[model samples]
Target: MTATTAPAPSRLQRVAALAGAETRLLLRNRTAVVNSLLLPLFLVAFVPVAGLGGDGPLGPRLVVTAFAVTLVFLTYHNLVTTYVARREELVLQRMRSGELTPGEVLLGTAVPTLLVTLAQVVLVLAGTAVIGEWSAPTDVVLPLVALLGGMLLMTLLAAASTSFTRTAESAQITTLPLVVLASITSGIVVPLTAFPEQVAQVVRLTPIEPVVELARLGLAGQTWDGRSVDWAAAPQPLLVLAAWIAVAAAVAPRVFRWAPRR
Candidate 1:
């Protein structure tokens, strides 16, 4: 009998392989690319043209919020749904048997989506700067914090949502609630500042609120308050996001299926 041997790749190598494959697959899907990238650009362009008027601080805020929504819904949420579907189809199960670990799988899957979001943010910022005459950010750290937090939150939210999704096709319908809520109340279509004080207060408690506020403040070269950068003002949103992340991380490992529901 001949002896058989195999080489195990390092963790980093496995992650890189998975990430590269996922990124290529994502790019090949024309519809997904368009929905993830072009749709948001269209909204960014159309909203202002439809009398939203990019003339002041609110204009840049709206643009950034819209861009962020697109990043969350089209890329983050969609990727989660797709990942769950793939897992249920036994794709993830087989991959797990290879060099990739669960953590590697999740992180690798998110890398491409995060890159797409970054590109979208750049496009939106450029468009707003040109059309709305918006200034570049003053305190870039604030918005970077928001973006990082938002990406992490969205990934966790996706994992949580996948637990409820029985099939790949069902993911489309299942993710609608978050999509709608984030679109309206997250300051995408309208500024939270425009809402009544009580309503704004309530909205500010949501996960997306702080992100939008931070992005707006960052773009305007302003701090949380007129005094200085108060990271405390962002606590509620960050807490909400962190709670969601904890829930998803805890629940997904328990409930996520590696084979088809049937």
Candidate 2:
């Protein structure tokens, strides 16, 4: 007798199942929980005290910096640890043996962290709107592109970083260079304008630079020189982000390891 073949799970079903499992795993890691969720809020609280640069009220700039910090800690840093831990545990290797494709495995693993980053950004924006008296973004599309593109790039970066991370504990060290560089250069705490012309020009080429520029342009509606912008101003930062994404996407597949390092 011929046996009937069960229909394969749809992409959504597959990703959702993987994401749900990842969520549960993420919840169990208290350090990751606090760092990814609570740490960003704590950092955002200091934006007013830190005094963001520019000609506008602090609300829009706060939103911009908050997005930067959130993507750094919540998405990039957390995923670095997650990838390392899963690799050390053979979780990635096992996932590859299943019905999941490589892209599915990576996206599923990142979904939990990405969702947390999104929630934290929303919370920060809400708090800023109420307390800082902020208004809606002048151009919503730029901010969305920044956040989504940042998440995708950060996820790819995390996976690529795992090539050097020997253990979950070492992820902290492996991730520090980018974390520190991005925090300082990505216009999170310091505006790119604070640097000299040549320095700022170099910083603009960094992976995180475009995300910050897009955030500022979208939320504050102003460029570094305090000039208001429209959709025309969006292309420069958008292209930078696209370039970074393409580089990361290309590098990740080449560097990403499905098995743990010896």
Candidate 3:
């Protein structure tokens, strides 16, 4: 008798399988669902209510800020905590025993969250336009580019953050820096254009700056003349975001544990 072996699945096939499974699992979690959807809506609704103003440039700023907050809190932070939880629970370990690679696992885990984020973005834009009287994009391409880049950078940062997370519970605390910074400096809570020259310059160095700036420009045709909001003037944010992604990609595989470190 001749020995036989099955051919390995292609990367796309593996990713699809894993992503589908992950999506199903994510949907089952009520907390995840609420945070992913409800929180953004709350932010979008509440910010304007809190006297953030709804006319002129302030209107678009509030909308963009709300969107950024939603992205960071619901998508990025939530995913990290969930990833760590899954890892500690050995869900990742069991999956690794199969044909899935680490990249496949991460991609699979992130797919559902990404979908939720995209949906949230759409809803926010639509809702703001209807209720908050927001306008259309000034430069559609810029916002799309920023959002895509932001998602990529944030995903990698979440993966990197997981290295410090010993347990799912700890992930809540671990993700605070990004959450706080996103709110404070990413033009989410406050516009960079409104800041003093020195203060805005400092804020521009953060990872979330580029995305928020691009978003503002896209939504309201706003840009900074002092190199803070000017995308060309501050390439460091992009480079820093890229560097984090590269380092996370390099280190996550080696350090990532699929099960609790007993």
Candidate 4:
């Protein structure tokens, strides 16, 4: 007789399976579904409520939608809820003991939400192309990277938050700080430009500010106002975003909980 061990699943296979299961779970949870979709939709709807910006909205609209979409689906609402839910249910602890590595566990969680976000980003871009005064980003690379970085940072922060979250129900309150900050100071709810120069500079220091700036810079001058975007202003924001990501990365492994807090 010979003993045999099963081969580990490839990262792609593991992630895909986890994502499929997670998607179904997300669909079943009415609360998660609404928070993921409706909350972001509310922000999208509020774009008009904010009134036309200095530009009719092509500019402000693009930035707001991009930031809000990422914030809602990627981090604040979706990931936090899922993390706490999984932890409370012992789903995360079970995954840890299985073939799914820790990285696979987290990646699997983010991918489904990432797919949802990808769809929204494309839809908004298409809308801009059709009705917007300017169609494309001034520099695609910076904005694309920044938005991606925002997703990664937000995802990391969501996992780190689970350290303090005792249950799925408490996630609603736990996620509020990031949600409120992004809504107020991160340039999603109101463009930093509307703030005074002093205030704008201070606001830019917020966690999500660089994320919004990336979208703003990328979408530059595509607004109804037809303002000109300065592409030269990419480095500082890149550094700011990178720094926040570094901090989150440092905090994540330390703060991440494998068992429910008693």
Error of 3 at 31 (Å): 3.3
lDDT of 4 by residue, 155-233 (tens): 8989898888888888888888877887777655576677897888888777887776666666663321235655667
Two-way lDDT contest, 2 vs 4, winner: 2
Give me the displacement of residue 139 in model 4, in angstroms.
1.5
Ranking by TM-score: 2, 4, 3, 1
Candidate 2: tens digits of C-alpha lDDT, residues 203-236: 8878888888888888888875567886777787
**Best TM-score goes to which candidate?**
2
Distance from true location, Cα of 146 in model 3, Å: 1.4
Clashes of 4: 0
Task: Provide the overall lDDT of each model, using Cα atoms, as 2-decimal numbers.
Answer: 0.68, 0.83, 0.72, 0.71
Local accuracy of candidate 1 as per-residue lDDT tens digits, 113-199 = 878887777777666666765665656777787788778777767766777777778887888887777766766565565788788
**Compared to the true structure, candidate 2 yields what TM-score?**
0.93
> What TM-score goes with each of the models?
0.82, 0.93, 0.83, 0.84
In each prediction, how many residue pairs overlap at the backbone (N, C-alpha, C within less than 3 A)? 0, 0, 0, 0
* lDDT ranking, best first: 2, 3, 4, 1
Using lDDT, give the best candidate's number. 2
Candidate 3 achieves a global lDDT of: 0.72
